[model samples]
Each structure stands twice: as structure tokens, then as C-alpha cells.
Target: MTMSAHGRPLRGLADLRTLTGRSDTQIPAHKAYLRISFLELEKARRMQEIRTANDRFAVVNARFREIDAEIADILASLNGTAPRAHALEAPHRSAVGLRPVKRQFQISY
Candidate 1:
């Protein structure tokens, strides 16, 4: 391969042919065409990857919103019942086996 003074491979078509050892004159044209097609394929692959990532992000974001709404509903229910829960008294129990058992519920804010 022909190298420039800076030690980089030469960019000329003659240099390309010499590096590849191709006696055929059409190698440069064919290589250029194939390179363009390969670049197009790479571009498509990158776009698909981006699309997949975006779809996953959207799904995860939706799930988070759903969980947040569920949490809000649970909090609202707890707050709503807090006052009524405190006003309710424990139920009286009948004797079982020998002695009566009383059940108590602890309420904490």
C-alpha cells in the first residue's frame, strides 16, 4: 500500500487497487458501491435499536404512572378511614372454653 509522508494509507484509486492487488480496473467502483450499501444497512440497524429503546422507555414510564396512581388511591383510602376507625369501639366477646377474650386494635398516625 502507498503511504503518505505522514504514514497514512493513500486515498487515490490507484493506491486502493495497489493495496488490494486487484488487476481488474473496476474494483474501486464495486468497492464504493458495496460500501454505500453497507453504510445504509448500518443506519437501518441503528434506527431499529433506537426505536426499541424508546418503546421500552414508554412502557416503563406507563407502569410507573400506574403505580403512582395506585399509591395515591391507597393513601386517600387510609386518610378517609382514619377518623371513622378511631371512633369505632371493640366488639364484646363471649366466653370461650373457660374465660372471655378481648381483642384490641392499635391505631397509629
Candidate 2:
């Protein structure tokens, strides 16, 4: 009773052929169904991988943005100007719904 990521139960080749009500003599139909099932499973697996990669990219992008903000703050201070409002903002959740760890930066004049 293996289940797919979409919660659908996967069926064996025999079970699939039986469900089609095709007799053993109908080998072509069984082969066609098996190919279709294989393709569908492959598609689901690839899609899951893509989603995982997207989540990782989002986390990396968020970290880069935080670094940019820190750099901006340092530049402003060196120029004797006020820092941006978001310079010292609290850690926020990324697209993956995970909050990044807070980091402290010390700047010497």
C-alpha cells in the first residue's frame, strides 16, 4: 500500500491490469498502462525535488538580503548618516516558513 506524495495509493502492475478488467491476452494494454504509471511517478518525484530546491533557494536569498542590509547600515554609519529603518529589524521567516537565526555585528569607528 505505497502512497504517492499526493496521497494516492500506488498499485502494482498486476493490480493495475486487473483494474482495467483486461484479460491476460491483452498484453499491449497492460504494457501501456505500466508505462503511463511509470511516467506519472517520475513526474511526481521530479516535482518534489523542484519544490525542495526552490525552498533552499528562498532561504539563501533571504540571507543575502540580510547581508545587504547590514552593509548598507555600515556604509551609512561611516558616512555620518542615519541607518535604514530595517537595519536592526528582528529575524523574519523566509518563504519556507523557517525563521533565520539572529546575528550580531560590531562596527568600530
Most accurate candidate by lDDT: 2
Residue clash pairs of candidate 2 = none
Give all candidate RMSDs, comma-separated: 18.1, 26.0
TM-score of each: 0.50, 0.47
Collision count for each candidate, in order: 0, 0
Residue range 1-109, candidate 2, lDDT tens digits: 6678999776776664434554565568878999999999999999999999999999999999999999988887789655556656778856796667797777989
lDDT of 1 by residue, 5-87 (tens): 99975577554434455477566887999999999999999999999999999999999999999999999889866645456
lDDT of 2: 0.84
RMSD of 2: 26.0
What is each predicted model's overall lDDT from 0 to 1? 0.83, 0.84
